[model samples]
Target: MRQLIIRAMATGTVATLALGACSSGSSDGSAKGRTPYIGVILPDTTSSARWETQDHPALEAAFKAKGVKYDIQNAQGDKAQFQAIADHMLKEGVNVLMIVDLDAASGIAVLTKAKQEGVATIDYDRLTLGGHADYYVSFDNVDVGELQGQGLVQCLQGQTKPIVAEVNGSPTDNNATLFAQGYDSVLGQLYNNGTFVKGPNQSTDNWDNATAGKNFTKMLAQTPNIGGVLVANDGMAQAVIAVLKQHHLNGKVPVTGQDATVPGLQSVLDGDQCMTVFKDSVKEAQAGADLAVNLAKGQTASAANAMVADTVTGKLVQSVELTPEAIVKSNVQDVIAAGAVTKAEVCTAQFAAACAANGIK
Candidate 1:
């Protein structure tokens, strides 16, 4: 079955075509093959800002260096729109399909349909299970959750017996479960030890900020003396932080987040939020694009030493799992240096003094 998939992918009649043998000799670190046209399907722009601000540009730049043409489409938070975009790209004859898989069910449906037509799929940043996705590329998601939990613990170290609320990401997302496992692994130990009290834990839907805001408000109402919050990402963290601000508890209670978004970084610098996790998106985007080009050319992700264990599928799938770094006020510059966000964006007018104090200039 794998051989048949590879052979069909090599024909490149559906999406893009990989041009050569699977080798490490390509200048851009891709398999030795002709440049292949690539298609990228991102989930809603609202779910996470990183999709457009970071991943899109990084993927485009990486593909350009590898001599590949790329087409991109954003679903804009609509499942029907996501499916339409995938169908359109398939019709356009892209050799490979790389998607962020906002709604795994909808994304898998598209991927499964594409696979039947001899087009390969790469799950980008988010995994697409229950469907035959050709490859996966992103940070170790469980590690991301563990980082959030551990960071919150460290920030709450000197406090008295504290109450913690967990504002996790979309419930439909399998990664959300992985994140909770990581957080629970650490926090559960703390809870068992009686050092921390867990309270008001719930996962958001579609990672929507509005949903996160309402849930956060309810969680706060339920746990009046909450000491910290383990928010899954920057988006949900911002919503939670806004509610904290209303109660004058913004900087008082420590919060953990991921993606190191602009508001999250500013909150960290302003002492409103505690920290965030910064995934090396450039490396991830390049890895995904390289895999897409490789698969399009009939090469294997194994050629790049990228193999991943998919507990969801009970198989070792083709993938590259990158590491994530914790970003606090102390190391916000590291995220800037990583090009996750520019100094200009992070050090705006309101943040000028904070930037100068931190030597960000």
Candidate 2:
């Protein structure tokens, strides 16, 4: 379960994001006149559809603008295959390797090998450790969880004995740990203070929706009067809601989710989900592309090569973190403004009335 990112201060213009920080390399990225090639390795083809549906497209667009070529691969959740993917990309002479490792441990081994070959490696979305990965790029997950907790609390609206259930993401995902930490900071306080009682607290592997649905069904059975559910992401939240519908409990219980997926937004409109965290994947993908291009050209990522001790490995590594937004019915327009989703995507015929009532038009 990845935690939610808190709102970041507006940095003025969108392009100004370039000046923030870099994952690795020097300030200028690479040297001049190098048309470097990049390799993007994804963990799996599941969870949120944004990786293929949104991220790949946006990243390709960014790379095209820089006159760069990129090769993208998916490991399909296989450990050996992930390492093989990295080996193949490295053998292909890719200047930089960007990976969204589904299996962090195996990914770290891949990065270790890549580092031996002088290929700059980035731990994308999921952090890979082993003194090999050069940089990390992801949302402030802990803050994202905090936002979900806050949103759920507000949705409950003074329910003194609110009963809440938590459905976290994959246990293998360290991001889930960070997210749980963030959520605990908020809800843990209430739970400890006797204002809210936690019902079922479980972690879903692979962020699988069906798995989430089953776990939620069992959770609802354990606690028949669930007031709210804190699901790690929109994908899992949708599954939880589907189970809720089985008990005719949909829309009656406020649910929290991350990832402003199309279905997630529609669920929000339909009143099945209370809120979701919108991490501008395009922005994140563009940033990764920029860093990859720079690294491939033999330039530094940016002047900011600050070090942070890894919680998992205790090794210092370069990092660039982006803040995620809290998306609810009231501020769904912000997501549209960011071009994260199309108006038509959320304002379909079935959602026409809800969209209008929410002022999404």
- TM-scores of all models? 0.89, 0.89
- lDDT tens digits, residues 1-361, model 1? 0100112223222223234555633534332233466789888778788989988898888887777678988899888998999889888777788887876689779998888877878888777766567777777777888898899998998988899999888878877877888888889999999999978898898999889999989988877999999999888888889999999999999988888888889988988889899987787887777677676665654423345555556665665667789887878898899888999999989987888888775
CA lDDT of each prediction against the hidden true structure: 0.79, 0.78
Q: How many backbone clashes does every candidate have? A: 9, 18
Compared with the true structure, the alpha-carbon lDDT of candidate 2 equals: 0.78
Candidate 1 vs. true structure, TM-score: 0.89
Report how far off residue 322 is in candidate 2 (Å).
1.1
